[model samples]
Target: MLVASNRGPVTYSLADDGTLTSRRGGGGLVSGLSAIGAEADALWVCSALGPGDREAVRRGVGEEGVLMLAIDETVHSDAYNGIANSVLWFVHHMLYQTPLEPVFDAEFRRQWASYESYNRSFAEALADRAAEGAAVLVQDYHLALVPGMLRELRPDLRIGHFSHTPWAPVDYFRMLPDDIAARLLRGLLGADRACFLTHRWAGAFADCCRAVLGEDALATTRIGVHGLGADAGFLRERAHRPDVEERMAALRAQIGPGRRAIVRVDRTELSKNIVRGLHAYRALLATRPQWRERVTHVAFAYPSRQDLAVYRDYTAEVQRVADAINEEYGTPGWTPVVLHVKDDFARSLAAYRLADVALVNPIRDGMNLVAKEVPVVSDAGCALVLSREAGAHEELGEDAITVNPYDVIATAEALHTALTLSPEDRLATSRRLAERATALPPTRWFLDQLEALTAVG
Candidate 1:
């Protein structure tokens, strides 16, 4: 078996002493694949993301069963930042300020060429590494072209591609150039099975194929949905570790005595809607002054895609709104909003365990794992204020206080309702949410796709 993604399960860093150090990654994919055990033969093909990675590749030093391609830096930047993050990400998330931005000019065409080269690198590597009739799983929009490119190189390989983002609606997706839109659909259809996170996204993909290439364009490829779920066992055990416990105590101190916490942990990505979430919290404090000193919004907005100007500007706006809220409602004894910008895993787990209400109101998301994770690890059951637009809402909406992501007023009321829930009611809802959230563990999710892909032959 072989897995291909833009990032692998491990990374390397250089030490001042000229020695290299390696660090393993943690996520659903890593957890799922690790459950397969070391005995199973597998390889993870990924790109070199930085100078350290490129050096490690050049020196032939890396983890066994992993291949890191050191493509030219300029090519990587154009493909990664120019096309993938700037263009494709915006289209899928429906995030364009359409009238003013997204100019598809000569520069875009050049970057598109680099995107093709980036994917071809991966395709060539997979073709060389795979055994006869090997099953290959390609992950996410970054590698959307790999399936088709690889098919042309090796017809014997069984390929599966999984999209971890919401597929844009038919009308929204048409923003791409005519040729580019058709090329993306055809690239995805190259797989024997194309998977999405939810039925809505799957339907959107099928609609796109029909819209771009006629009604029968989807006849050759099968569509599947496997909503990834939280790993309860891991979260349960990890939440009680010493580091987590220490962070939990520290967070409790910052939150003050008898104050309930509304927690949100997310990267400051455009679609996360962190700015609007802060607005909702501010609305809650303003409308219900009695709860002003009794609650604190603990937000962890870790910086993401900082290389892009728009992302940097968004991150700044998040801080600006958060600061404005704190400045407006804050007192020496009670700070209404407690914000953290750094990325810390143990600290996130701490926030998850201590949350009284978990706010997962992304404008659009593939599946907000935080929604599922908080319920599993909450010290005292947590209420969920979720966005209907998030894919996780498909499974958790019944138990959550669902809100329109764009409606700050409704979200504010929902947050208030979540904060005031009786202990027993909150506990019951949390139990149900956790049950639905873990219905398909990460191991099961990955294995299901693998099984489905291999079964086609």
Candidate 2:
């Protein structure tokens, strides 16, 4: 089997002594694949982003039955970020304000050419490496065109594609120029089966294939929903580590007595609604003065895509909002908001363990793993204030206090309710949440998808 994504199994970093060290990836997909390393031969074709990655790729490094192939810098920049993030990301996440006309200009056309070249690179590589009738799994928006391109090269191979983000509604997707939309749908149809994270997303994809590519294509295209879940064993084991304990203790000490923690951990991206979340926290402080000193919001928003101007601007906005809230409501001894814009997985687990309320209110998300992880690792029974738009909400909705990502005042009220619940009620809610969160572990989720694909064959 071959696994392909935009990022590989390990990212390289230069050590203090000038040695190159590779750090394993953290997301559920990486962990799940690692856990099942003995099952099959897996070759991961990913983009080489930096000097370290390029060096490692050139060395033909192989470990844990995983092989890494890195694409060129020009292809990655123009295709991955320019077209995937700036174009398809907006279309799928519904981030654009389309009241203003969206132009498909010369730059977009140039980037589209790069996107095609990038996908062709992967298809060529996979074609060269794949055995006859081997299963090839392509991941996310970054490589949507690979399945079709690969199929053209090697007809005997079984091709599958999975979208890790929401598929846009037909109306929203139509914002793309007619040619681009048609090409994307046709590209995906090259796969024997395509999977989405939720039934809604799956249906949306099927609808796209039907509307854009014609109903005849739908007869051959198989769509499935594989709702991704957290790695429960990994979270549980990490929670028991001494470093996690120490971090939890430090966090508790900082919050002091009689103050509950409202926690959110996210990449510093516009889609996360970080600034709006801060606005809601501020709204809570201003409107409900009684709860001001008793609560602290711990927002750990690590920098992401710092090279992009929009992302840089968004990170700055997050800081400005956090600073403003602290200024308005902070006491000499107590800060109303503790904002850490860094990526520390252990610290994130510690935050999950220490949280009184886990706030996962994304404007849109495929699956907010934080919602699931907090319930599994939380020391006390923590209430989850989840956005209805999150893919996780479909599974955890019965236990979560649902809120719209746009309604700041309503979300604040929900937060207040979660923080003030009685101990018995909190415990009960937490028990149910933990049960739901861990019901489908990552290995089982992956196996189920594999089984479904096998059945399709």
Candidate 3:
């Protein structure tokens, strides 16, 4: 089986001694497939962006089994950032607020051409590596057109695609020019089966295919939902490491006593609703004076998508808000906000363990895994204040306190309620969440997809 995605399984980084070291990826899909190991002769095809990546790819440098392919910069940038991020991502995540007007200019068309070229690159690579009857599973918005392109090239191959983001409703999706939407739908229909993170997202995709591409498309397309879950064993082991313990001790020392920790770990991106989340926290402090100095918000916002101007602006806005909040409500004895903009997995695990309240309020997300992870390994039963917009809401709604991402007052109230929950209630809720988080492990997820693909074949 060949799995195609925008990012590879291992990323190469230059070490202090100028030696390249490969770091394994962390998502549910990666961990799930890794568990399957040699049983599933999985070949992951992904693009490489850096010089080290190019060198590694050219020299055939990587672990024994995985195959890495690096594409040119021009094609990757225009296709990935322009078409995938600017066009498809906006359509799927419902990022655009202005429904009345959308800009589809010459640059968009140019980028769309590059997007097609990028998809073709993957198609050609996969077709070469895959056996005559091998199954090729395509991933996410980045390579939507690859399945169809590959299918056209190799008629005997079985193809499947899974969208890791929410599928926009027909009304919102129709905002894309008719030809663009039709082409994308037709591209995905090249697959024998399609998968979504939730049934709601699946239904939305089906509706789009029906409304945009017609009922005839349904004859070839079968949709399924595989709700992604956390890897309990991996998270549990990482949570108890010495590095995590040292970080936890450092956090405790910094915050001092009688202070509740509200933690949010996210990439600094426009869709994360980070500024709004901080605003809600500020509202909590402003409206409820009692919580002014008693709560500390540990925001672990690492930089993401620095190539785009909008993301850079969003990152600045998050820092500005964090600074403003601290300036408004900080004493020499204790700082109210601790904003760390660097990516540190150990530090994140430490934060997860120490979190008294986990705030995962995204504007829209396929599934916020942090919502699941915090409850599983939290020292004190962490209260989750989740956004209704997150895809994880379907599975963890009962135990979580759901909030509207845009409503600052409601989010503030929810935070207050979460912080004030009794110890027994918190523990019970956390226990339920931990059970739900681990109910569907990663190996089960991959096998279920394999089963669906096999049934269709």
Whole-model lDDT, model 3: 0.87
Local accuracy of candidate 1 as per-residue lDDT tens digits, 197-287: 9999999999999999999998889999999999999899988999999999999999999999999999999999999999999999989
Clashing pairs in 1: none
- Top lDDT prediction, candidate number: 1
RMSD of each: 1.0, 1.7, 1.8
Ranking by lDDT: 1, 3, 2
Return the lDDT, model 3, position 128. 89
> What is each predicted model's overall lDDT from 0 to 1?
0.93, 0.85, 0.87
The digit string of per-residue lDDT tens for model 3 on 1-457 reads 8889998778887666768878887676676677777877878888886777777777778876567667778888999898888878888778876855469889888889999999999999999889878888899999999888999999788899999998899999998889989989888989988889998898988899889988777797788889888888889998998999999998887666878999999999777898999999999999998997788999999999898998899999999999999998999887888999989889999999888899999988998888989999898789999999899999999899999999999999999999999988888899899899877777788778877786775
Span of 10 residues, lowest total lDDT, candidate 1? 28-37
TM-score of each: 0.99, 0.96, 0.96
Residue-level lDDT of model 2, residues 127-177, one tens digit each, is 999988887888999999998899899988888898999889988998888
